[model samples]
Target: MFSKSFVRRALSGLAIAGCLVVGLPTLSFADGLPGFTLWGGVKGEDSLNFRLDFGGRAGSWDRYRLRIPAKKMKLAVEQFAISYPDYYKGEFDTKNVEVIVKDKSIKLQEVRWNKDNHLLEIYPEEPIPAGSGVEIQLANVRNPSFGGMFYFNCQVLSPGDVPLLRYLGTWVITIS
Candidate 1:
């Protein structure tokens, strides 16, 4: 038979343990660079507006939620831009864009582009955890047309620790 005080202490301990278990990961991840940006857009040359929602109430380590509005365009897309600062003048290869969700590789199928719009469609190869986010790395981005362009149309997903030259690109997200 346990006393009232014992029960209360047990409950308090359980609550604290639960909080630590839940909060530790968020804190650990909080220290690392923020994840990728999530943009929204349509297929054709039409413009789409979207919103980015950072989950945390205040401070850093906030998670972002993207709001992609409905559109009457051919395809809804989210775009990001990668640019180098003035000092670093070099060309980047536009062919190396990889999307990683929670360390799992995601396949980005290249969509037929119209002029400068290098489009990619995101189909999650594996099931993504509910609250987990992704990282978008544009490796070898050293092309003439690859830097300093205003990559809009989608929501900016992650707020990185360093000033990322890449605009996190856009997600070819569907808005139905």
Candidate 2:
């Protein structure tokens, strides 16, 4: 036994609440979008490697390199992602970076980013044909330049407060 006015008021309140919940995310997302960049670099002793340059206070960039022996020229990079703190906010611009193999550029497709898992995965549009020595470089990254402590890692996602680190390793790809 309720009046029409009461029911109308209740419905209006619920609608407002729903709109607030939905609108909040849209507002937050609009402020600071996340982006990423992909590049290649060489891994070895006493090498500069690659740079994970940041432009703001909450973003960062990092690079990892792997050297494959001539004998092993085929390997599957099944996993590649970047992780940060739950509070961290930013994006990655993938177009600025390039992946060079034997001085020839390779196309990367199927790029997927998972915020829940804090991972970024990419698969080559075309497989690298059997080849000898290959060099990979990860460069041209734009990230947050604030906080001055933003950190990033390859294969393992970390937070911004910790010491900024990079991953360096080698992979063997054999075509047969």
| TM-scores of all candidate predictions against the true structure | 0.28, 0.38
lDDT of each: 0.37, 0.42
How many clashing residue pairs are found in candidate 2? 33
Name the top lDDT candidate: 2
Candidate 2, residues 32-94, lDDT tens digits: the string is 222222333223331222322222223345332333333333333322344444443445445
Write candidate 1's Cα lDDT for 1-176 as tens digits: 99999999999999999999999887655422223335533333333332223222222222222222222212312333322234323333335555555466666544222234333333333333334454554444332322222333332212332432223233321111
TM-score of 2: 0.38
Q: Against the true structure, whose TM-score is highest?
A: 2
